[model samples]
Target chain A: MSWSKAMPANPVVAVAGATGAVGQEFMQVLHDLDFPASEIRALASARSAGKKIEFAGCGQVPAGELIVQEMTPESFKGVDIALFSCGAGISKEMREAVVAAGAVMIDNSSAFRMDEDVPLVVPEVNPDDVSWHSGVIANPNCSTIQMVVALKPLYDIAPIKRVVVSTYQAASGGGAPAMEELYSQTKDFLNGEELKVEVFQHRIAFNCIPHIDVFMDDDSTKEEWKMVVETKKIMGDESIAVAATCVRVPVLRCHAESVNVEFSGEVSVEAAREAYETAEGITVMDDCSSNTYPMPGLLAGTNDTFVGRLRKDPTVEHGLALWVVADQIRKGAALNAVQIAQLLLP
Target chain B: MSWSKAMPANPVVAVAGATGAVGQEFMQVLHDLDFPASEIRALASARSAGKKIEFAGCGQVPAGELIVQEMTPESFKGVDIALFSCGAGISKEMREAVVAAGAVMIDNSSAFRMDEDVPLVVPEVNPDDVSWHSGVIANPNCSTIQMVVALKPLYDIAPIKRVVVSTYQAASGGGAPAMEELYSQTKDFLNGEELKVEVFQHRIAFNCIPHIDVFMDDDSTKEEWKMVVETKKIMGDESIAVAATCVRVPVLRCHAESVNVEFSGEVSVEAAREAYETAEGITVMDDCSSNTYPMPGLLAGTNDTFVGRLRKDPTVEHGLALWVVADQIRKGAALNAVQIAQLLLP
Candidate 1:
């Protein structure tokens, strides 16, 4: 029963925090991508440990056979790459140890994003930054990642002077419990009963929550701050200003953005379309004629960041506006970390 | 038995789109505010001409007793003030006619919005504009009326250089049929059947559509165009820029907007909050600590525009952002029109 017909020599690739939504997607992607992994390891919290997990119908992964091991620096032994989709707290606790053990840790938490030693990577947007990873490559924020992937190529065509983005984020980014919050609250509301709130500060079923992450003294939430700083880092432009208002939409999987951009020089709507059409990991859905454009329902399950609603900002001399939608769980998180792993594969 | 003994000398008022959602709200507001209307002439089209409607248990209003008349010039001859929430075509043909009959027409339609002679008024934002109207005072687009009303006073204090708003609109804005479409589609989706969309181009059961109105030559839709033009006319600053992405959400009422504002001078988040708190018709719902803010569930049945998530745009020198929620059919269209009628008491 040895399956050794076409495996790559990367030894074994492990996905830490592998039982959650993003974690499950990581396993599916590894199999879907046919990554050259000689061995595969699925890990999660100790409680989720010993759970049976299968990959690509690769037969049964028996319970208690592969215990959900703890994420420790020692856990990185013999692993060529570790895709970390665990929270920043977990990444902080074990990332150093795992990287010290020789595995290239691609952390999907904010712990290392602003770290000068860590290179924040969006393969299509800034693959060049990958070369400088100090054994710990950082994954940008979910909202920030998709925005940069959509804005980078456009920025190259016409330098962006400022970016105004307001995100309608999906609940899946909050992990499984937040998904439960939306589901349970929705049923309660439809039944004409008062919805109980816990996972969120307010009822999230039929409403939009303006707060994401902890609020700063300045009133901006941490999620909003990410778009501000991450854009400057990923685009390698300190002069280009960015502002964001992130909202938690009742949607379950995709993150959508309405973006207004001001460029340093004149850039027509057609030119902006040309810029995105040629960029990798980006798709232009700018068919305002049929009202055909990027939207959450369409972006779900896809890997590409959808960009649309391209038009000249009639208010400014060199400005254009667009609507961006992307699968936050995919390109915004798990898929991106996996792609970074692919870049490291032999 | 003459009930005239109890009636004040208040003039008679008529509601042209009675029986519609906004019309019902108008009736509620009249009762709540104890508006000094000696009598209420509940008016509607021929089909609903014989239906009995109730409001605050004021007594049943028989549609047939409503005169079962068309909204003709002559129908308005006795109306001291006509508050209209009818369709655009109906309002267009009757607006001037109503005025000719010595009644002030407050129309909730795009039919007269861009007309230079018709003043687009959001009473709280600019009651003075009411004086400029010959007789037909226009209600700005539902989305525009709320945003500008929330931003107008702030714009005066800081002078908005640019505004980028992404609206999460409700189905009722498209009228009752759209609301039915949302409900029916949800049931169909639950039954595992493919949902058929009639009111919208795509399935909107649990989805958000970025399209609103037909697209124009410049790629902007009629909905977006109205917001841009109406904001200027209502704000009396044609030079003030606005870009909007109007979306139809699954909700039943209250349109929410994520607004990013870049002003001429530095606008602190604190100053913005104070500005909204002082602005007429604007209710500041900011309290990110508890996540208490503008939400449709809380905003439904309300007349005032709710503002929250007020924060400084950290990316720009002079920027402030917000999340604004208001009952689109009410503040966005109906109540605002009613408020204008209150401005001119004979």
Candidate 2:
């Protein structure tokens, strides 16, 4: 069931849900990567139809204001690639129309992530999974994206048996309104006003919310569950066990994870550092003497996954611990999707 | 080798470092617990001498302002109990003097925590450990105190083989100045002014700092090491393994931990919840249907250690995961030390 389509040297790109946070990031990443898009279109809901989104164009696409058009089934008529940051339902609803028009969709939603027909990809971990996608590719959750990027290089050293991770997730993972809520609530809290907590279950201004997304029957949030199942799917290994606790902190964009990994065989701290140093899309920022490690606030808008605080966990026979941080909207969303698009280029 | 002091029903209590955050909390908790004190003395550095702190009435002590006195070797004379929240150096320097004066020192510093003769205790977990302390009873680190309280009831179900905990610590753990720094820095960050990061290694406003305390030779922070070693000491099981990642979050007071525990035998979520419901000094706040759990911002000033988000981890044969939160100043430090002081009363 291998599927492949010949992508043009410079494809026509459509940025769906162009008014949202990750949607804007998709445009920025395309320009940052100098993606060769012959034409770029901005598509959104009817409410934002006439809005103008400025694009620092890429390749043949001229730098100008892109008029937001109301997205319809026909929006992808000649679009070679559609980058979607729309909600899951919208992504699913437009899936058929997107595929019918012969456009490849790199979706940033959780709609088709676990589907057998769609490839859940982190280019660093499993680029070849793209070869088997029917017409769509799914990006992993923001928290999962950064973690597996850090884990892949180490997994090459030894098969990872288990991972116990606790995340210091940022507000941006909840999208634009969530970020705005954090901003306004923080100002209100400091001003001695009642905090308006609408985007999240609790006041996310200076608090940590252990719940993310929706709760499952098992009481694990869908965000935590996504990390567990998506990692196995992307890593293409059903044997690797992942236990994740996703918590939302007041950080604006970047997410940090304290990950404890157990491997089937011993992997020393020195060996793990050497492996990460040679691995692609990873920067080692670990230096205890200098008091250096990745801080989420300082790492917003970064492309590479930063790994630090590498140490051996003496509790387990073959355990290693590390701190991972990456910009949730960039490497965790838009940048990752665009990277997958580059892989599709002929 | 064992020592016990006969404490009078109404003994004089001296609060060392009375002007600091935990020291002030010690005063509040003494009043909250209705501690019996014939007279209360406020002791601090010479700079703070003559300053007055207001205290509510506690038992035989009347409601009034206590004049601050410069602490010296003679300060402990005729003092039956000395609750110390001073820095480690001062605690170490004054230890022998306080002990020689026949005053039992309940130290809130890390000075003698790991010492062979000092009992590092969380009153809820190891009250009996107080009997072996020759003079000073060490209060466990704020992060460790809350965790051991949550772990104790679970440990009663089955022997915990190992624990992996990640902390979302508040600013208050660093003392009153640190809390003030957070306040000012957060205001600066929101107002677009440059942040002054004097108390912490980095700007902690809307950010998470993975490095807490000093970095050890193993690249693990000393705060992380404290949790590892202190948990084993308080739990009285040298075989139990613990790995901790201590991060300072933006929250002002309470500390929250995402703890993953593996036991020698299976411990179901139902049984864990039941144990927590009946456990002393514990509150069960988990109810996913209502989006209920312990949040640090709302849990400040609360006395009990809260356990929530209880779920079984399918990663290990006998594993359970839970989130624990407690006010760092209350259960973690002041209240625990005050409880230990109560144990000495005849």
TM-score list, all predictions: 0.92, 0.99
Return the TM-score for candidate 2, rounded to 2 decimals: 0.99
True contacts kept of 2: 0.86
Give the winner by TM-score.
2
Q: Which run of 10 residues does model 1 chain A get worst, by summed lDDT?
A: A57-66
i-RMS of candidate 1: 1.7
Interface RMSD of each: 1.7, 0.6
- What are the per-residue Cα lDDT tens digits for candidate 1 across A231-295? 89988888878888888877778988888888888887777777777788898877755668877
Chain B TM-score, structure 2: 0.99
Q: Which candidate comes out best when scored by DockQ?
A: 2
Worst 10 residues of 1 chain B by lDDT: B1-10
Candidate 2 chain B, run of 10 with poorest lDDT? B1-10
Query: What is every candidate's C-alpha DockQ against the true complex, given to 2 decimals?
Result: 0.58, 0.90
lDDT of 2: 0.93
Please give me the DockQ of candidate 2 compared with the native complex: 0.90
